[model samples]
Target: MVKMGTFFGMSLGAFVFWQSMDKVHVWIALHQDEKKEREEREMEVRRVREELMQQAQQRDSVA
Candidate 1:
């Protein structure tokens, strides 16, 4: 009877631990995705700014 009780307790603890870990993993993945998206947006903005500057220089040269 004591062995059975011990087994039950251990199983319950393991289950709870696994559930919490799963939630943490999901949260970390979501944060990483957001970070990647932000980086991509910043890169695009930089590219656009460079292109605009080049166009302005071309116009100035023509005048």
Candidate 2:
């Protein structure tokens, strides 16, 4: 009976540990995705700014 109880306790503990690890894994993945999205947005903004600057320069030269 003691052995059976011990086994059940260990099983429950292992299950809890696995659940915690899964939560951590999901959290990290979400942050990574957010970071990538943010970086892409920044790159797009930079590209647009550069294009606008070039257009302004061309207009000035023409004038």
Candidate 3:
């Protein structure tokens, strides 16, 4: 009887541990995706700013 109880307890603990780890893995994955998106957006903004600056410089030279 005691052995059965121990087995049950160990099984429950393992299940809970795996579930928590799965959640952590999912959270990390989501954060990584968000970070990638943010970096891409920043790069796009920088490109736009560079283009605008170039245009301004050209106009100044022409004037």
Each candidate's lDDT (Cα)?
A: 1.00, 1.00, 1.00
Angstrom error at residue 1, model 1: 3.9
Compose the digit string of candidate 1's lDDT tens values, residues 1-63.
Answer: 999999999999999999999999999999999999999999999999999999999999999
- Summed backbone clashes in each candidate are 0, 0, 0
Residue 32 alpha-carbon offset, candidate 1, angstroms: 0.9
RMSD of 3: 0.5
TM per prediction: 0.85, 0.92, 0.96
Which run of 10 residues does model 2 get worst, by summed lDDT? Answer: 1-10
Candidate 2 wrong stretches, greater than 4 Å = none
Highest TM-score model number: 3
Please give the lDDT score for candidate 3. 1.00
Ranking by TM-score: 3, 2, 1
Score candidate 2 by TM-score against the native.
0.92
Q: Name the regions of candidate 1 deviating beyond 4 angstroms.
A: none
Clashing residue pairs found in predicted model 3: none
Measured with C-alpha atoms, the lDDT of residue 16 in candidate 3 is 100
Candidate 2 lDDT over 11-31, as tens digits, reads 999999999999999999999
